[model samples]
Target: MANNQGRSVRQPTLLEVIIVLGLFLAIAFSFVSVVDLPIQLALFIALFLIVILGIRLGYTYNDLQEAIKSGISNGLEAVLILVAVGALIGSWIAGGIVPTIISFGLEIIHPSIFLLATLIICSLTSLATGTSWGTAGTAGIAMVAIGEGLGIPLPMVVGAVMSGAYFGDKLSPLSDSTVLTASMAKVNIIDHIKSMLYVSVPAFLISGAAFTIVGFTATGHVDMAGVESTINSLNSTFNIGWIMLIPAVVVIVLLAMRKPPVPTIAFGALLGVVWAGLFQGMDWIAALNTTYDGFVIETGEAFMDELLNQGGITSMLGSIVVILLGLGFGGLLNHIGALQVIVDSFKRFITNTGRLSISTVATGIMANIFGCAMYVSLILTPKIMEKNYDEMKVDRRVLSRNTEVGGTLTSGMVPWSDNGIFMVALFGVPTLQYLPYMWLSFAAIILVIIYGYTNKFIWYVDDEEEGQGHELDIASDQKA
Candidate 1:
């Protein structure tokens, strides 16, 4: 009894596994159900402790400690990226990027074609901003109101925004999820994007076509007053100009240079502050305030103000908490050995590529059901597939593609997830209402699974390309 904590590491017990699963479920459910509460943080600290407990009970001291350190280290870049994104978003609005995007969105896209317009405009905006949340808060909201004015179904509008948001989110260099997925799978960013288009390309074409047909048939006018009033308010608050794009151009160039996202975004935000102070005529103090503290304005119409009155570092606190807690859940699993136990239990049964793909799909779905978070699904998949991937001699990117082809794209379909909750609140449409129209995301998943079984376009890395020179030693062993 005195030496139990000192005993060598052993297999994780079933109870330990349940604790890991339970932590993920609690954080996901609580965060979605109650966004105001920091249930994610609560779960993070609790899960962190649980891992330590699991280590004391079963894992060796060094193994337990090292896993925790490694897991946290894995998320360091993401944590930096998150903070930089928050600042960039805050200052971008202050610098007129968001307002400019919205003004253009309203100028050309009419309510008569609002749903299709929403999908198209938001896809472009998300690609520009590299952020789904930013597009949703800015242009997406404006599109919703326009869609509503046209008497379009809220479900269709939300589905359209989601489709576009996800499309850009999947490919944008600025996107944390995109960067994270590519890096974790050890795939080059360009390779990951190209590989994903195999499935995403068709899904995108079909989704866009469907929205277009529906828009052509749908008819009604938007509240021009509200749309115009909001743009006017934006124009008043910030000096909008084509020159406003300098900061954006600088950011894009930095990303193209393959600079890390954190520095690029941070420098972009700084450029935004300087632009606002000099070109936009905001005081230096005011520029800084808007950059860090969020800018609010009474656009006369409360509805318009609600749309524009957002941004700053503080706003992303909730997402940050959720992410840390999500990663904490992952850390706990790795610490306890329960994650490995679960994977091993599955890997023994997998015989070929077909079964492995099927299992991956199931893993993604189950992760969604349990965590109710798409990114969390990413964190869990590498655990399940790491060993089988090594055994099958498949490329890591193939495993990564399977993880995301479904997992990241399907979050909005879950009524209990954050994306679903946000959608429902944004448009007052229930998740069930938009489920049918979210064709692309669902279609993508199905196509991947069927294609996996049929072995169509399923490219695997040849032994020659498995250039794990230094990393191979530490890549996929059950022990490390």
Candidate 2:
């Protein structure tokens, strides 16, 4: 094919795209699951293969390098957030913020409702902050420790945290993914959120009910004595007080006010250092060291030491390397037209609303798997499918909603993706271990497909009412 500038460009064939993607997946899964190696090495191998594919497609090394750079650039913000979160976790633990929260949670929350409470807490935190990463690194960490104290399964706790965090992230207007999806589809952000409610609300309710039922079943295994022991260790080791919560309060207030997440989180980390010095009796230097190398304590209680002895900038280095390699692989695929070819191959099947919805979800998931970041999927999927929605007269809000359902919700399920890597590093739970329990993501995907086929809550553009604030027509036998 010839480009706009008349330069020759070889578009990848469907077979070539499949082979490349398949090989990457195989290598990644093998290294992570079978070989028990760092995911970065696997991603590096995959990236090298993609570079070879780009060369065979007539792209120069410079072109491929630029593509990789561009892809990494897109994820720089997330990379920054990861760094900030690492410091936040370390400092919070040192300053007794996390320990205090965990101690209070152990005392107040009964085992029968711990899972349900975790879901609600994480959902509210993410909704307020508009960043699932922040929520998970902060409140999510505390919840995991508390769940451990109560003898709840680690995977189940992590699953509830994941579901609640993404639930709020998908609906919050302040969320970068939500805003990007709306912008790509050329729709109002509020309309985009309202459109998502048709699916998100149902998913939230279902997930909550499931958690409640599961919590009841799981409480039979509760270890009350262990919970008390953990709480006592927390109080004996750190100055567990209401004052320690100031750092967390500041973070939430700043983020809710639309402050930049990076600075707000950094400030929160700094506050943690100050608290550690004042309350924990650590000198300024030792307190600051915790931000980079992570907090350490010899509480004599093995479980307490294991749970509290985590966080720091150094802790996130491995995940950062994986993210960079994953982004580079995604960038090279786009540069060589591999990703585009895959999407084009699906075009023929998207002949109606139902098929379109399915294709959009599939493409979003594919983009996350290949692009290795939620931003990549959120930006690329809607841009690719916008014209199709317009031609079919479907409301752009629906396009935005489906894009989020597939992209934001599923990002954490892919081990190499930014969200997935963060989750694994923070909670020490493998993506596969928690995949079956990600109720919100699964429910949303199923509901969107059902809505498409049933013609319920599907809106169409009305040419006659195109302007003057006229309402669009909802394509449903039942009232929307």
Q: Highest lDDT among the candidates is held by which one?
A: 2
* Candidate 2 structure quality by residue, lDDT tens digits, 1-480: 654345577888888778888998998899888989878988988888888877777777777889999999988987888888889889999999999989899999999998999999999998998878878977899899888888899999999999999988878888887888888777778888888888988999999999999999989977788888888888888999899999999998888788998988899999999999999998899899898999988878788788999889999999999898888888887778777788888788888888999999998999999999988899889888888887898877789899998889999999999999989989988999999899989999999999889877787776454332236544431133
TM-score of 1: 0.72
By summed lDDT, the worst window of 10 consecutive residues in model 2 runs over 469-478
* C-alpha lDDT (0 to 100) for residue 428 of candidate 2: 85
TM-score of 2: 0.95
TM-score of each: 0.72, 0.95
Give the lowest summed-lDDT range of ten residues in model 1: 465-474
- With a 3 Å backbone cut-off (N, CA, C), the pairs that clash in candidate 1 are none
Q: List the residue pairs that clash in candidate 2.
A: none
Query: Residue 316 of candidate 2: its Cα lDDT?
Result: 91
